[model samples]
Structure formats: C-alpha cells, structure tokens
Target: MEILRLDSFSFRYPHTQRCALKDITLSADEGDFVLLCGASGSGKSTLLENLKPELRRNGERTGEITCLGRPLQSLSRMESACDIGFVMQNLEAQLVADTVRGELCFGLESLGFPPEVIRRRVAEMASYFGLGKLLNRSVNTLSGGEKQLVSLASVLSLSPKLLLLDEPASQLDPVAARELFSMLARINSELGITILLAEHHTEELFTLCSKAVLLHNGQVSFCGAPREAARFITQNRTLSSDAIPPQTKESGSAYVFTSLLPSAAKIFPDEPSLPLSVREGRALFKQKISGRTPPAPMPVIPPTAPPAVSVTDVYFGYGSKDTLLFHDLSLTLYEGELSAVMGANGSGKSTLLKLLCGLLKPKRGTIELFGKRGAKPTLGYLPQNPRLLFLADTVQQDLTACAENLRLLHPEERIQSLSEALGISDILSSHPYDISAGELQRAALAKVLLSSPRLLLLDEPTKALDPFAKSKLAALLRGLVQSGVTVLFASHDTEFCASYCDRCALLFDGQTAATGAPAQFFGGNVFYSTAAARIAAGFSYDSVTCGEVRNLWIK
Candidate 1:
C-alpha cells in the first residue's frame, strides 16, 4: 500500500519569487524508510512540512498529496493527528510540558484519549524510548540528546502510522545518534510504520535506509535505492558528493556504495565485494594483512608554548554549590590552534564554552587570557542554536546591524566579503527565519566574525551542515587559526574532530579527562572512535581517518 504520495508539488513562501519546492513528485510505500537529502536550502525541510498538513508553512502551494490512499487535504483534523507524526530538528521547539511524563501525556490527552489509555500508552512509550528513569525529570534539565529522545517518545505515544523526522539527530552524540537510528529501524521493521527523514548526517544512515530522495535547487534530482543513489551522486561529481561515504569518496568508483568505503580500502579497486560495516571491513583486512608488520608509532604534539586561554581550578554550576557542573576543572588552549571538546550529552561541554566566552562566571576559579595578568581577549561565541544570534528580519539587516554596532568604516564591504565566503550571498535578502538551518548557522558565524575576535568558540557548528559545507567550514577555521585567531568548539562529530582539529579534549565528570592530538585522542577511545579508525586498527597506529589509512596501504 502507498502510505504517502505527492504529485507535481510546487511551493513558494510568501514574499519569495522562487519556489522553495518545485514540481516535486515523490512517494513512499508502506513500511518504507526513505531518506530525504539535499544541500542547504535545497528544499528538504520544506517538502517535509508539506507532507504533514498541520506543520505546513503558510505558502503559495500547488500540488496533490495523498496519505493512506486518501487526499491529504480531505483528511479530517483527528485523522491527520492520529495518522501522521512529525518530529522537528529543534527538539526544544516541540516540547511543551515541564516534565518527561507530562510531555508524553500532552499529545495523547490532546487527542481525546481516555485517561487510562493515555497513561498506559505513555508508560509504554517511556519504556520503549528509555525514558522511564526520567519520568519525573524536568524537561529543561535534560541534555540535547535526551531532549530529542523524549520528543521522539512523545510523538510515538500518539501511535501514528507514518512518521516525519527533520534532522532528528543533528544535536546528538555519535553513540546516542546510532541508538536513535537503530530504534527507527526497529520501528519500521516491527511496527510497519512508514518513515520519511530529512537529514544531513548520512554516514550511518546510508546502510539503514531503503531508499533516498535527493533534492537540488528545489527539485527532485534523484529518488532510488541507497546504493544506486550513491553511484549516481559519485558519477555526477556534484558538491553533494561529500555526502557519499569517505571510502566511496576515496575510491572515486561509482560501482561501490559509500558504506563499503572502509573495506574497499583493504582491497584493490577491482575487488568483487566490499564490506559496509566495521566487522566486515576488519575481516577483509585480516585476509589482506595476514603477516604484515604494523606501522611505527606516530609522534605526539607536546604542549611547550604558552597558553592562549587557561583555566585554573574552575568550579562552576547553575545556581547553588550542590548543583555544580564543572568541579575543579582545568584546561588550556594554545594560541593559533583549533581545539575540539568532545563528551557524552550533558557532560558540560556547552557550559565550558559559555564560561570561556564570558557568558557565565566561575564560582571559584580563574580564567586567564593570552597568558597575561588581568587581560581579556576579544571573543566570539556561536551558540548551538544559531537562531538566538539573529535579531533582524533579513540576513542583510543582521550583518549590517552587526557592522554598524562594531563601528566599521566600510560595513558594506565587510558584509559582502562574509556573504561570499560563507556562500550565502544569494540569501542576503531572505528573512533569517525563512532560510535553512545550515544557511542560518553560517549567517550567525558571519555576524559573530564581524567583530574580529581573537578567541572564537563554536557549539555544534556543524550540527545541520552537509559534508561539503563541513569541509568548507574546516578549511575556513584553519584559515582563521593561521591568521592568529584561536578556536575552541564543542562537537559530537568524531570524524570531524579527528580529521580537522589540531587537538581533541574529552570532557568527562566535570573535568578534562583526556587531551591530546586527534590521532592519540581518538586512538585511545574504544566506543567513541570513528569508522575509519575502527577499520584501520590492525594496520596503522593512531590512524583515525580513511585518508591516512589509504595513503599508508597504497605504498
């Protein structure tokens, strides 16, 4: 049975000349897991909103949408609410109640379910989503990942047949994200619910999803099996090629899927089969290197230079001393270097960033700048939610306002330079609220960079960006570091931190548990490592990237 279908769907937001979604025709059969992919502003989110009538944005729309063989427009309010469940990218935006139990009950109660039925369904959902321990916990106290899980559980309590998820795991750590995907797979397989997901994090999902819908310039570019989509994408050499798995990118072979990249490295380009997961990749590697010698140990970076930002015996918390988050924590960031902080959700990564950026004060500690006494460095901070940084209607207005506030003599030139560098020149006139999440992040970063801060802090900067955009951001941050700006960012992207950052720090139990170069930092971690690192374990020492492993084996 066809669970959902769209015919020649075209939509344009109010006051916009171009269509956000142009003639998009797509469909999903019952029990299908469809992944919707595109570059920033390519209309993935807009198309998702169109699928759920209640969530659709006010726009000029022309299309025919069908759900469960009935016209979507003709479905009654109760039917729509009970059949389609939509989970947003921003978890906080969807949460309404104060506690976990309350949030789970809100949806069921709203739909006029009996009290006993609502209670039973809420308990089942909490157990299914692992929210039982947090039933009485305040929603505000939950971590980003926990909040997202709760939001998902709440939607599931309504017992919808079809689920629409928009960048659902953009805020979660790698472990949490993998768990969420696994849960989604189970839901599709056991419950027979149709799932349509719009997301940028494609690494693990490529193997999990049955089909993919690739959108570009507000149109359906390709819609097919995951493997076929990977081949087509690689052959075309589009900027979205980064969305292909790292191994697939390395092989440059349209014949193989991205999921098999790790195992592809262990074999020649002419190999008949490639492994998609680490277990298979490791088996392939064992066959290739039966008696090979392991590579020599790599040198570690020594911390000899003076620190740029230093914290000594920091003790901080939200309110009272009993609620401490950072307990006697100490850290150091060197000048002209990019450092990445990683940890489990709610491990105080964001709190550390806030303290470093002067958004909060330490209860009993000292944070010194530039290794100088009583000195404060000019700072720039980009919060996890970039929308908080925007105050104006349009991107142009926000940038212009920032420049004016900073008293730049040539504000126009600065705005143009940032606009071009961030690849957001086209959306300069668009309202900040109307742009895509990736575009908004870049816009906010541009707004912060206008002041020319020496020390920069970013919280989950790559949360919603495509792989190409992430690469661009890495290069941009490297350039900034080379230009004498020090950067400290909190991220859950292990591959990104291992590949791009100069150093990686693990924040655990209110302190810096481990800190070292990316190679050493990730090499020591067991579960927290990347796919490349896991696959290349036997052949190379401290090789945490596919490129590193490939270069050594090719010789």
Candidate 2:
C-alpha cells in the first residue's frame, strides 16, 4: 500500500522568486526504500524537509499531501511525531543529551513512555548499533560519525514507521558507511520500515534502493527502478540538442549527473547493462581485458622537495584530564604537494589539521613552518563545519569581507572568478545559512582561497560535495599546487584521495600507521580502497582511480 503520496506539490521559500520544489508528484509504498539523488541545491533536502511537518521550512506551499490514506496536515502532532522520523545532515544539530545513553532515551522520554519500556528500547538500540561502549561516553567527545550513529539510534528508539535521512554516511569511513548501509537495508527488509534517503554517495546504495528518484532544478527528472534510472541517466547524455532542456544543456547537468553514478556505471556507460557493484564490475572488466595486456605500472618517484610543514614527536590532547589523542606522532609535508590524511572516525584526522594550522598547540613536540621553528606563515584552513567560517550574513558580504581583510588587489574580480568556479555565483545574495551544505562548503572554500595562502589545511573538505564540484575543487587545487602552494587535507573520501591527491596517510591508534603515494597506499588496502581499485584488482591491475582505469582501457 502507498503509505505517503504527494500530488503536484510546490513550495517556495520566503523572499525567493524561484520555487524550491516545483510540481513534484511522488509516493512511497509501505516498506519501500527510496533513494533521492540530485546535484547540490537541487531540492532533495527541501523536499525531504517538507515531508516532516515539524521540520518543514517556512515557505509558500501548495498542493495535496497524504499520509496513510489521510491528508498529511490533518494528522495529529503526536501521530506525526511517532510515525515519521528524520535524521538531518548536520549531526551536531540533532543531538541533545550529554551522553549516548541519554540521547537514545531523549525521544522516548519526550513522548512520556514508561520507564521500563524506555530502558528496554534504549538498550536494544545501543546493542543493535554497537554503541555499548559509547553509551557512557560524553556526546561532545564523540566523532562526527559516532554522533551521527547516536542521532540515528535516538530516532530509531522512537520506533517510527518511516525514516528520512539526509546524507547519513557523509562523515563515515568506507567500512562504517558500508555497515550503515547494511543496517539500513536490514531495517527496511527485516523491520518493514519505509526509508527515503537523500545522499550523493550512491555507489553502494544504487543497488540496495528499491527505487531511485533524480531531481534537477526543483523538478523530478526521473523516478523509477534503480537500474532503469541508471540507464536513463547514461542514455540521456546522447540525446539531441532539442531533446535536452536548455538550462541543463548549458550547465552540462547530464555530464555532472553522470559523474554521480557508480564507478562501474561511469566506466561502462554504453554497455548493454551497467554493473552496480565492484564484484559485477570486476567480472565485466575481466571479460573486457581477457586477451589484452595490462598497462605498465607508473613509476614511483621519491620526494626531493623541501618541507613545507614538519612535525617532530608531537603529543597532543584536548583538556587537562583527557587522555592523549596523539602520542609521539611525526609527519612531514613537502612543498607543492597535495596530500590526504585518512583514517577511521575519531582517529584524529581533524586534530592533526588543527595542530598544523596553529589552532591547537602540541604538548611536547616541534612544529616548523617553512624551515622556521616558530614562524607563522600565511595559511588557509577550512574546518569540517563550513558554517563556522561564515562571519557576515550574506555569502557575498562574507567573501567581500575576507578579500578586503586580506588586502587583496582587485577583490571584485577575484570574488567573481572564485564564485563562478565553485558554483556559488547565483547564491551570493542569499544568507550564508540559507544555502545548501554543499554550496556552503564551496563558498567557504572560496573565502579561504581569497587569502592566497602559501600553505592550505582542510578538514573533511569533501564532506558534502557532489562529484562535479569535487572535480572543480581538484582542478582548483591543482592550479594552486602548480603555483608552489602546499596543501594537506584530512578526509574520509577515499575515492577523491585516490583520484586527485599525491600522497595518502593512514592514522590509527594516535599515530601515522602508513603514508605513501595514493597508488601504493589505497591499492594495498582491502576495505579502505576505492571501487575502481577493487574492480581492477581482479585483472592484476593496480589502477586506483576511474581515470586511470578509463585511460588504460582506452589505450
């Protein structure tokens, strides 16, 4: 049965001329797992928020919405609260309690559940989500991924029939993201709960989703089975000029959306059928390269460049009583290099960046910037939460302030160039908080670049970006590196690191476990590698990125 339905729904935020969602007619059946996907600011989040009345934005809304055979707006507050659950993109925004246990019990208590029942539900959620050890831990000390899990558990404790998630795995590592997806699948299959998730990371989800919906410019471009949706997207790129929409054609939305597909889909777009997973991709790859010789391995060159940032036996921790998060940690970043620091959640990736940017001082170690022991060099740092970087109300104002404060020459030209490159030119007049998370990330990056820092440090730089924006960022960073700037970023995006970064460092148990070239680093790992590497591995190929695999196949 259809549990929810919308008939020609339209919504426009206050003070905005364009509707955020336009003529959207959609439905979700009971126990269905629907995948919502689109480019940044494409109205996926807006639609999701509109479904939950309590969280819906103040907007000019029109049309009919039904839930369980009744009007959505007619449902009682308690009924809606108990039937629909939402997990927001920002993990910290939803968490309320101090400890994991308390957070799990918050929703239950709010609804005035019996103490015994609340206890039972909390225990079950904690055990099910593997939060047993963290139950007593402070929520403030939890990593972004851990906090996300806690928020999910808290929502699940309410036993809602329908779950809505926005980029739930954006902050999770590969293994953890896989596990989260698996858990979500089980919830849909075993528990019979319907799920509608909006996410950019569709590699694993593409195969799991019962249905996929693609949105573009506030409209449903495609809504069908996942496989059919994949084929439609790939096939649409070859359509005639008149067949495509003018705005879409000009923006190359087809190409941008194609990049959001799975690596196998991207690599074999013209195939009779696209493979959705690495296993199937490997099988197809083996057949394609059956009689062909593998490409020669790329040479590994040792770095002879001077050090840009050096850390010697660093020890650091948060508060006075907190245990040391980093002990005897040492690493070096050479000039004109783009390096990535990757590790599991709570493994100190953000902490290491903070130390390098002088936001946090090491307890017992030496940190030198450009061969000086205590010198402070010009640098740009983008934190995990892009909202923290915003000082002015509007994006345009914030960027202008940044450029002016830095005494940049020709500030208007610089701002305009960066805004266009980062795809934030249209939203410059909007408030910084009004834009999408991905848009906000790019805006923050534009501000950071306005400084023209010699060294750049980023924490989770690709947290909410789509594939097209990532490519733009990669090209921008490449240009910076060519101009003799050095960059060090911490991320959980193994695919981005493998494709664009020069070196990858793995941090485990408070120290650098391994650091080497991307090919040698990700290619050597089993679970921590990209899908392209895993697919190529079947043919004894060491290709770690889709570009490399595509180039080799072409050759």
User: Taking the tens digit of each residue's C-alpha lDDT, what string does model 2 give over 349-373?
Assistant: 9899888888888999999988999
- Kindly report which residue pairs in candidate 2 clash with one another: none
lDDT of 1 by residue, 238-297 (tens): 222222333333444331223222223323222344344567666766676667778888
The global Cα lDDT (0 to 1) of model 1 is: 0.82
C-alpha local distance difference test of each model = 0.82, 0.86
Q: Over 4 Å off in model 1, which ranges?
A: 238-274, 288-290
Error of 1 at 517 (Å): 0.7
Model 1 worst lDDT window (10 residues): 254-263
TM-score of each: 0.93, 0.95
Deviation (Å) of 185 in candidate 1: 1.0
lDDT of 2: 0.86
Worst 10 residues of 2 by lDDT: 239-248
Instruction: Please name the candidate that would achieve the greatest lDDT relative to the true structure.
Output: 2
Off by over 4 Å in 2: 238-253, 320-322
